[model samples]
Target: MSDWMVTQTPLPRRRPRALSPLREHLRDTFWFAPTAAMVGVFVVWLVAQELDAALVRSLRDDGDFDTLADLLRFADDAKTVVSAVGSAMMTFIGVVFSISLVAVQMASGQFTPRVVRLFVRSRITKATFAVFLATFVLTLLVLTSYDSGADPLVVASAPLVQSVLTLVMVALSLLLFVMYVNTTLRLMRVSHVIARIAAESFRVAALMPLPAQDGQAPALGPVTAWVAHEGQAGVLRDVHIARLVRVARKHGVVLRTVPRTGDFLVPGTPVLAVHGGQAPPRRALRYALSVGVERTFHQDLAFGLRQLSDIALRALSSAVNDPTTAVQALDRVVQILATLSRRPLDAVVHRDRRGTVRLVQPVPGWTELVDLGFTEIRACAARTPQVTRRMLAGLDDLLLLAPPDRREPLLRHRALLRQAVERSAPSPADRAFGLQPDRQGIG
Candidate 1:
């Protein structure tokens, strides 16, 4: 029998209520920024009111009537501007975001749904929403503080600090608007979107750098117990690896994860298998794995590969029939593959300070990643001479970087590509042209 087996027995259902998971959830949300901005703006309004009162008192005590008069005139002039901005801000937010969302939708439809997450998690998107709402709120607060019937000093206090703050907010909102427009337009372009995804994937690769080769894990005792996932079906987004290692060390057991970061989990799915001594509490082990509705690039290194593949596949589809986009995606795919070539792709083993193996987390190795990046594109691009040529070039480039052990997958893909071109291309000339490796496809 296999080392790990799926059993029908159900593990205890324990919902993950950890703060780390909660932080991760909020980090990806669109509403969190705006909500936090609202709370922050209210506090700023109170501070602005106090500062306005203090400025009025100081100016009155110093008998600086001329400067005070100038300030009031400036405030009056700014009132018209601020009021206009206040009223238009919300509508501006709606229109800008609506158009931006439409662009995002079109890009997603053109590329892949995974690209939406990149836009959502963008700092510019969150900053744009936060600044727009804050400007509108601050403007309303400043305008409502005015009173014509009140004394000159009372009215003077209203427009001092608050008016300045509102004006600054308006300026920030305008700047963010320009930036948002530029970003949205760039997002509409396929090259920018593909580059963004590849850049993010590169960052992930840097963070989770693999060793040159897999190190042998210390031997442990036999299997003792199994822990299964008992919750609504979801993707395994991330894991608290440190906590798992600690728990295993304390319990004197070895825990091996059955599914990888991007795998989907349903109830009764074997999540972890215990080896050696006593197993840790099922609750701790279950909570260590953060499962969510969808996969995130947070800990799932292969998510970028998945996204690029999706874009390439969509471009090659009959509905789109855009081979250039596929070639562009293939460009990034090869770049990522080249980077992964120098690193070891193997199961990650975590050990305690005493050199005892505590946890084993399986990940996609070289062959799997190679197949993932090439197989679909090769099959889909066989009929398209440009894409096939680009793919062949990509595979050859990867072959130079990949070590001896890693070259097998690259060689296999190259042969497969030649076979596909021979079958898809009618004439010998066409087959020969398709097999010729060109980094820029036809170019």
Candidate 2:
């Protein structure tokens, strides 16, 4: 029953695509690699210290170092052995940890590297601290177990315990990662929607073509001067067409015939019964005037569109918390979008089936309406769902008003409109109303 309820059941959510291999590699390289390396180095150092203690005690008990040189030589050998063993152990642990992390991410349905990167980018400082703390805790646990005296049971269980700890740490990391990633992505998507709306508004403003001040009036060949009487209706009471013709002949420009009053004169269309010799100044004036008029028309369209877009944007912003106001703003936006989409201002060129192209100038004021409409649609697209629904309803209204020929562009952009609607769901503030505003309002 709600206007927002285009469908009763919500559309099924699609599974997001997996991140590409290249993206995964880049994420790992940029975000994960440095932290992993640091942890690995620290772990190796701890292992080597433990190993050196064991070796040093053994060498001292054996009494193999009677001289300082010999003792130093033996110490060097012990250090090398400890370093090799520690390095290998650290490498093995790192590999296990990385594998567990990836597996947990895959299982949690957050396998995309884009998601991971989003998380990393959002909470770099927090995540960095987490990594440091995790490494320290893990190292303490390992050292504690080692110092507990290599009890057969404990030693045998060490690998399993390490694996379990790795899994737990990886799972925790992923949870935090996803939270940050989701938040970042949402913010980014919203920003993009807003920007798109703003751009459309500018496009509308560019439609106006105001005439330049430098423009000149077009020259008339075989010009005739006539005075009009007050309250006269197509009556040339005093001046005859023949007399006008004689005057035109006095000038080099000759009028073979005169057109009847009230004859329509289209731009660029030839007028009959007029010829001129050496009318360079007249030709120049005509060209300048034509260009100036075209420019003026375009400027007007642009200015109108800009104003319309601004109004829609302001209305949308205000409607955020107030349902009634929001609905009204949405309605206005829809009206503007529908008009713009239906009838664009300025001249649009289209090719016919015969492959010949011709410029089509829209009727006056049609351009301004269309520009305003498109701007409104764009602004609505970036808004919250409640606002979007109102916008969509407005669009539907405008569509109804549009001529058949103007519907194609709106239909073509249907997918984008749908996406905007989906993205712009009403916030908690919007849902306080019993019914969706659009559904409750006039169709």
Candidate 3:
């Protein structure tokens, strides 16, 4: 089977990236890993300073010196080279910092703004920055130790040793700079960006339970109270299902989310329904749910799909008029929809460790997921033959490859696509060709 064919099959549900909101935010930040690396560099430089000083003193004291003297470069030469390298490192670090910011901006503008988080959290960017900064620091510290007078007690070896290390780091930094540029370039491509988003959607799909299960959902009683949100208005990014379930079970009540992930949660809106009269503190429930200014893919599987679809829609717009980009986006969207087809599509019910359902959270059904993946692209492709043909082919491909349970949704979407093409095509022949389920849009 091909990659998508294999991917279309559902796997066992996997754990969520963050059981809570704090961890999720922490995962997206820029400085955490690089800061730790910078600290390590600082400590290493400190230790190396002492070692360099000790080596200098020992070599000077040995005085059996011709070999020792020749082995070490002059203090002035060492200082000059290290200083020059330090300036270069500083300049490069500035360039890297600027380039990173530009890359983030480009990614945000070209792809979805959510992708900015990916660039910021990139390890390569952080490592490259850390390496350059470390070299600068090492050189600066060694420059202070450059003493020309042979005090015998005073060791000039520290500068020489530090210079050698600085040279090695300079070479390493040069190599890493090439790799960093390549990574940045790859991130800019729409194909790679779409593929990455599709892969992430699959990974997140594993976080939810399969749509069909033998176990029944817990009985949801009349809403005893409505738990209103108490923060700045924003999108409900994700709900900690396990924690919500635990909280509900602990209080012997049932809870159902009023708004799903990606839904806007206003400050005074009822975010959840509490049954059995007793409700947990608004703070506790709020903590269990993450509210952010924008949606993220951590729990909202549909957000990634929406982003790719939006990209395709824009590409197909009259302003962009890039049907090829639209086709590229649709290709991944089809695979992503196929992958979601095998995953559980119904509302997710969270059961406790003993398997008693306590919380019911809704997700997009098969029809909704299919609409999200194809509706915009299909609409935008109405006037473009190549894109229209690809959309038809994508639907047909899914119809053939997706499992039986997923076929109904694909069929519905395929029907929608035919109707759209029939209505929007410029002529009778174009409409007829567009409605066909062939790759080239010919009847």
Candidate 4:
């Protein structure tokens, strides 16, 4: 089935050179620029001092001719020692600066607050500091034997120090790289959580049985067996029925049960036949609602906002033919979108005057329609500001497909939905439901 299909799209390539110049400059300057500048300055000063010393020695030209050769050899040896020390110091500084810069950026407001809290509470910071300090102390010990008098110690310790420092640097680098990857994964997981919640909310709002004032049961149209198992006759307990009853009560549904034990039932055979109600509550809705009120509210709000946003955009496009007006509508649209930005979207069932029930857009099953609506809105926003006849047709199609029972609730909540739609269209990060440029013309 189409519902089970997973369409994989290639990820967008990274465009490092295409990034804004200012952003690129900031990234380069934050960690590397300072260290590079300091190192360059130090090297230039050292080189100038060495050149002056050599010039003075040449000018003196003492009677002891071997003095020049000894001074030359001493200078060469001193350069080697200084180079080694400088290299180690530069490596250490680079590592420290990189870590600090990355950590600070991660702590910034770019990610969810939960992610920031998780990273801040991590013990890796302390562990990293300890590793750095140990590396520093070991490097200092190795450099201590650089005196000429300790020739044997310097010769033996030099290679050992180099080897140890190299290994330490490699290990530290790997550790930092791993930490960065872990932080990225954590942020991704947090984003997924929000997306999943938003998706599920929309699904619930589109699929759940509509609320009714009259306690009438809905007819069981086609009961697809989601799960089937034969158990003991006593398995059908009062508790199970009570739970179903509670769900019915919440949705203003009435249930009548004719007790049957271990009876063979077909797909369309209603276990406890319902009547005078909207759609029957599915297991998913029950589970979602069971979580808690806050979650339910979040889910419902998100779904509602998404639906309203799509509807409003479609309506606005059909009404206005001008691009400027369409974009202007977005400003009004933003108000409705805001209410749903942080909330979850859920299904809300409604029955029509014709006594037929159908699911609406902004729900999981109506993904295709929602996508179409999103495309229409984006097109209108980009190309025309005025609503058009075509946009109205799209809105009409959406309204026509919605369950008839929802008319009253919708009319009653028209203002609410309008406000939400105006406020809740997709933002930059929440563009999963937005139109894709490539797919725009196709739809």
Candidate 5:
């Protein structure tokens, strides 16, 4: 979800802030949410302490000795319960997350390392850790307030509210634990993981505006200057597109990013090619491009396709020859390519108010995306009749939806699939079956 780009300003005249690389980093990590939760639990513990003291004072003053005695016993019982829950909670946290990490690791091995991002981004996993740790902390604070004085009345400054609150926290932690288990289990399933990847891809696609039917924009004069990257080497994750557009308009220049999103960058790599005029300040242009250790779906449109293909490739590998799983991955790939067939996937062109091109952000075109999605799978699945048949069907379906201009890649891939099958299949029967389009591969 952190991949959700910052919403761009509707009116170009208003300047929008650049996307913060730190925000993306935090969203990809696991620490911030649990740390905040513990702080919140500490505050709640303070409030419960005050409320418990207040209730004790009110009861003692009313000379309700009998009720106070019962309250004292209840507080003692609650303390024991809270202590047990608190001590057990840390072990529970360790066990749950340990199992979760193993599950995530196994999945990464079975599918692709990219899928580890899906597990890391899970909100349920974070919430479970937060609440479970918060409960443990709450119990520790509540137990510290318990007095061992022989004077019953004095000791009756009972942690009544704190005890009750701790019990409620314990209950909530149990509930989240159940939900976390369910979510973790779902993450392990191939079908579920494939569906999640597809869903995220579709979500990113939805954010892209349909291409303009017709438009003419001012052309760039020529390359005026080039801006080299001056940061830690990493993947070019996302660009602050709105901010680049604003900077370009302000300087009366055309700014073109040299590297597309998802490209690996070392320091001094040409990141931006300024056109029409000299480059903007290096700092100004630097922050507009967000570089990170790995790629994300937020700005890299091809990443989803890449991930799907990776899954299929892994499935078809000799180490794990599961053509059925490869077929399933193709199912989603077909859907994604079909959706893309209708949309304009040319380089994302940004224009100024006067309809002059200001920023040209390069992205994968239809041909490149189609090739990225199919080429590797086609080669790897060359002899697997199930995957070959399914791929043929998927390409056929895409051909029907593809515009005339976009059909070339599909037709080329179809031809390649047949050649691959013919070369790899052991006999004439297998070759014929492999070439035949089967929506379900074999069934």
Candidate 6:
């Protein structure tokens, strides 16, 4: 019944493989969505141009302009108006960007540097930018439709419709700019950033659910050759296990990886080793591995934990000393850890066609993960009673519903917290209070 309840159902069998770093990188970058919008708007502009021309030709043939005495004509004056609006829109865009960047920089300084990625990857911000740029682009393109020097009677002039559409675009851009400013301000708050990160982490945990481990990590005895990482160093975000299995099968050898996902692999670092046969072409093996500028949730599930933990540590540091933030981060960690408790961990035993074990890629187990999530923050915040008490409460909460396998580690971490409070609290009463499970201190 507790919020940290760890009881969970085993996940369905997953056919896991490496996520393409390039694909994920592009998705997170600022340009991808706007670039797509640009292409889409260009197509719309072309279609709108043709439709406007057709409307003008039809109106002229049917004497509609004569019938309407109040109709605004496409003239040199209209072109001048649109040109001015386009120039003004560009200027406003510059202002919006400048202000937004300042806000983002301030957030990074006050909150966490990684928080900036949220603003950069925001769909609303990207859409707002796209709308502003699209409107500017549309205004400029429609200017070419002007026939201020040519006779309206002979030229295909559709000034009234184009000008109206441009005005609509301007209105839409203004609305979007307002929305961007509001979103930017809302995201500046630390609570919103942490909540967003927590939400994303839970989504990732639920989507790429792990299964329970059957046993200890499988052993790959006597690898014949060690294969180091190639090229520039980055996080070894993912490795193609299927390819490794195939390589193992082809060589009648065993392949063993040196590090886990989320681990950095420097160039010339030993990443893999081939046993019982000649090593597979390092290039062929390297192609199956994905290295990225930083970690991602697609494969490095622990990276989310790491990011939140980093935020907590920074908040608890001497400079910031915000224990409330650390507690918030700890609770979110509990939420995901609870989710993981019910699911399985990645402990692979890849087999060849003959069903013989060919490769062993061991992912971090539950205990390793508990260490990853709590160890650093616990050390950093041992003296912060709010955080220590919250950690105790989190541990006790998870222990209640932790699966039979997880209870031990949860108890182990909880005891470590008790020891920390005992060692750091200034007095007996303070230690007693810090060890209490309630959010309120000394209660």
What lDDT does the true structure give each of the candidates?
Answer: 0.81, 0.38, 0.74, 0.36, 0.83, 0.73
Q: What is the overall TM-score of model 1 with all chains considered together? A: 0.89
- Residue by residue across 1-443, what tens digits does model 6's lDDT show? 00122233555466344345566667578888767876877788777778767876777788876632234343455677789888998898798789779988987887777677788777778888878787788788888777555555666645666677788888888888888888887888777787888777666555552322443334455667888777678888677767888878877788877787778878888887777778888666767787878666655667678778888988998999888888878878888788777665655456676767787655667787788889998888778888888888888778876777678888888888889889988999988878888643223
lDDT of 2 at 26: 43
Model 1 lDDT, residue 321, Cα:
98
For residues 1-443, write the lDDT of model 4, one tens digit per residue. 11121122222343122233233223323334434434543444345445544543453454344544444445445545544654665476466557655654653333222223233323454334444444444344434433444332112222232333435544774585467556545534424323333444344333333334343333434433222222322222111323454555555543433222212334334344344455354662342111111112222333333433443454345443333323333333333332222222222233444443332112233333233224445444432212322233333333454444323322333333233334445464323222222211223
Evaluate model 6: give its lDDT. Answer: 0.73
Q: Taking the tens digit of each residue's C-alpha lDDT, what string does model 1 give over 267-320?
A: 898888899866677776667888888898776778888889999999999999
TM-score winner between 1 and 6, please give it.
Answer: 1
lDDT of 3 by residue, 1-443 (tens): 00111122344555555446666776667767667766777787777777777776677778746545554546566677787898888789889988888888887776667778667656788778878877887777777766665444444554555667778888989988999999888888878887778877877777775432443434576889888888788888888777898889888888888887899977888888888867887666757878888777777878878988888877877777777777788878888876665555557667777767688777777778887888777767777778878888888888876678668867777787778777887799878766655553433
As a TM-score, model 6 comes out at 0.81
lDDT of 5 by residue, 272-387 (tens): 98988888987677578887888998767899899999999999989999999999999999999987776656566776677667787777888888998999999898888888
lDDT of 4: 0.36
Displacement of residue 227 (Cα, Å) in model 3 is 2.5
TM-score against truth, every candidate: 0.89, 0.26, 0.83, 0.24, 0.89, 0.81
CA error at residue 299 for candidate 1, angstroms: 1.4
Q: List the residue pairs that clash in candidate 1.
A: none
**Candidate ordering by lDDT (highest first):** 5, 1, 3, 6, 2, 4
Model 6 CA lDDT for position 99: 76
Residue 352 in model 2: lDDT: 31
> How many clashes does each candidate structure show, in the order listed?
0, 26, 1, 50, 0, 5
Name the weakest run of 10 consecutive residues (lDDT summed) in model 1. Answer: 1-10
Best by lDDT: 5
Minimum summed lDDT over a 10-residue window in model 2 is located at: 1-10
